[model samples]
Target: MIDTSSFQGKKAAYYTLGCKLNFSETSTFGKMLQDIGVVAAREGEKADLCIINTCSVTDVADHKCRQAIRRMVRNNPGAFVVVTGCYAQLNPQTISCFDGVDLVLGSNEKANLLQFLSEKWSGMSSDAGRNHLHEHFSVKTKDIKTFVPSCSRGNRTRYFLKVQDGCDYFCTYCTIPYARGFSRNPTIASLVEQVEEAVADGGKEIVITGVNIGDFGKTTGESFFGLVKALDSIEGVKRYRISSLEPDLISDELIEYCGRSRSFMPHFHIPLQSGSDSVLKLMHRHYDTALFAEKVRHIKSVMPDAFIGVDVMVGCRGETPEFFEETYNFIDSLDVTQLHVFPYSERPNTSALSIPYIVDDDTKKERCHRLLELSDRKTMAFYNRFIGKEADVLLEKASYGKAMHGFTANYVRVELPVSESLPEYDNSIRKLLLGDFNHDKTALKATVI
Candidate 1:
């Protein structure tokens, strides 16, 4: 009942703000537009349409989403602007009120974006249709059940495969479950097919991403381990990295399997929101400090040279001075490669609000700075251990200054000089001898082996 004629020769500009999953979904939207003969707008060129995918993890993220939507509208004159993702799903009416926004879609509506656009475009010429179609779009969180599949590179050498969507954990300070809905995922067979397609398209490395990837089998009867086994069997993939996993869900069997697997790298990212067991309990986290420490020890025991990244949130409700000290000391004792430190941002309608203690903005900022400084030391220490050693690195296409960058199998950043004698090695795995730190000390300088 819709005409595809209108879509021909259209150019769209996309803006995504958030996690790897958002970027993957945006790439899927780009492909959908391409299927209709709509290409991406070139730099400095005005677009006929603009799609902005948003995030609402924190109030700061919500502010950024609003700013992005406004900037896109201002840049693309006369463009039909569409907004979707977490921010839109949670606060649809607020975004709909924005002056230049044409349409707003939530998580439930995101998968059927093309269909929604068709329905809206069919009647835009008439005043009645324009008025009726110019509202926000989203179903209740409970109604969001569909698991849309996404496997995309998104202008990167490493393809991000979305193995799962949504989450079931309703941690007191978290709003992800409310925005993304209960946990769900596609069948293992379908995911394997996606991986095969990515490989055929020249993808060498894949980072399995999700809201909670370890809880992958919520919809299907398949376990995360089963999915891992299925993906490992695929050919052409040189490296595989599990983006993030909960400590409790990271079974010892899985750790040992990854250690012995052919493709899975010696890198792990696990979140330990607060190192204080009391604070973790207050945050409604599933795992305790003892269990988290045990997991870290187990990982180091099996993969001695592995890179372990931990996520630490500071100054949440009920986190007193003593608690913050507990967190800092605990992290200092761990052999983590780096820390991803976040200052707590209070979300609406959450159990965290009921807690009596509150951390002032200045205190939160101070705690974040302290943790980040600690992170720098830990990261530098990890990089120093690999100096003068040869490791296989997957060269990425991105460049910084006069240097090119790539990541080793253990997730160590390596910098190579841009020399006339050197051949182009983008997207190719090559062995490199790690040397001293780069000019900025952000990565290890390397020479091709």
Candidate 2:
């Protein structure tokens, strides 16, 4: 344990990997540190501590965690390093074995990080890394029962709010159910307070996120649609976006209500998983392709301009060549804005690992390539259809090549010229006239009104 008495005027640098959910939790950690008078790590300065929030969605993600830990150890000498989140929860001992990791916090420990620090680091020693991280810090993953709510302030324009967490669906290929706990969420009143706090912090757009957000309030009497409806009533936020949701849980009522909502943005990112019904069944997916397509149809019928993004996984067990084509054709036929294609990776103890048909690395690469190409075509078509139209854009704080960038309600990426007046528009919503495609035709150039 390191001495907290030495923490005066110290700074911490946070490095996070994985989804918006992880960032949300990490930002909360930063806020906790600030409450204790610690500051953010500045440029060219060695941090007093470094926090790494990890992911283990795939085998590659585990390797990335190892590489990140080694980089932190090598670059930031004498800094106390802490590794936590899904990867840490899934394999605490493996992460604890890393030479520089001072603490390995599991799911529940990460939520209440301040208490852990106060108890474990109340001045045992500043030379904490010499001893095993397990000797001073450890937590069991199963003891994590309650939910830990988080809202990500990744920037001023967009805040990723985690209203729900965990998953009840034990899909064959997914380890999310084990890594996170059973599906649960904060009460409607608690979530409304979080949204209000986000808006108070000058947040313009709030992206709703979680591990099965559609399955919200499983332990409570409320519902996901009810949660969104309450958020729609909030006055300060300009727009909101729902993250990846299951198709079956996306009711027609939610789609229709959001279509007419003043605050809800016209963008839906629904995970179809696969277009082949047989493959979906093999993976123990809840909904079939027909249901998924019907959900898309409902959204398109209510809001034709709405941007629909689909998440497709390729190269899972039993997905033969014909099955691949079925998925390709089914997605191609859907009126979606874009595709997020992922190549399936085997996880330990998953049911998919026992299945006989194992896709080769070369085959997985090829299938991933095919879906990515299809995504490029779909995105170009979607953007072209919106050309010369007008939409509201919440100008973000990032830019490239002397131009500012923002996103439309339907998730269109738009760029505008950066000038002396651009700072005034930052984090503010502006009426943008989507005009022409830029050179190489990746993003649309817009004129701010």
| lDDT digits (tens) for residues 300-388 of candidate 2 | 99999899998989899999999999999999999998888889989988988888988898999999999999999999999998899
Off-target runs (Cα >4 Å) in candidate 2 are: 1-6, 124-132, 135-142, 398-401, 419-421
- Model 1, position 310, has a per-residue lDDT of 96
Per-candidate clashes come to 0, 0
At residue 229, give the lDDT of candidate 2.
Answer: 90
lDDT of 2: 0.83
Question: Model 2, residue 427: displacement in angstroms?
Answer: 1.0
TM-score of each: 0.96, 0.95
Predicted candidate 1 versus true structure: per-residue lDDT over 1-449, tens digit per residue:
55767787888899999998999999989998898878999999888788999999888999999899989977876678899999999999989988678899999998988888787753243222223234798989899987778998857589999999998889999999989999999999999999999999999999999999999997999999999999999999989999999999999999999999999999999999999999999999999999999999999999999999999998899999999999999999999999999889999988999999999999999999999999999999999999999999888775534567889999999988876114468788889999999889989989987
By lDDT, who's the top model here? 1
- Give the clash count for model 2: 0
Worst ten in a row by lDDT for model 1:
123-132
Q: All candidates' lDDT scores? A: 0.89, 0.83
Off by over 4 Å in 1: 122-133, 398-401, 420-423
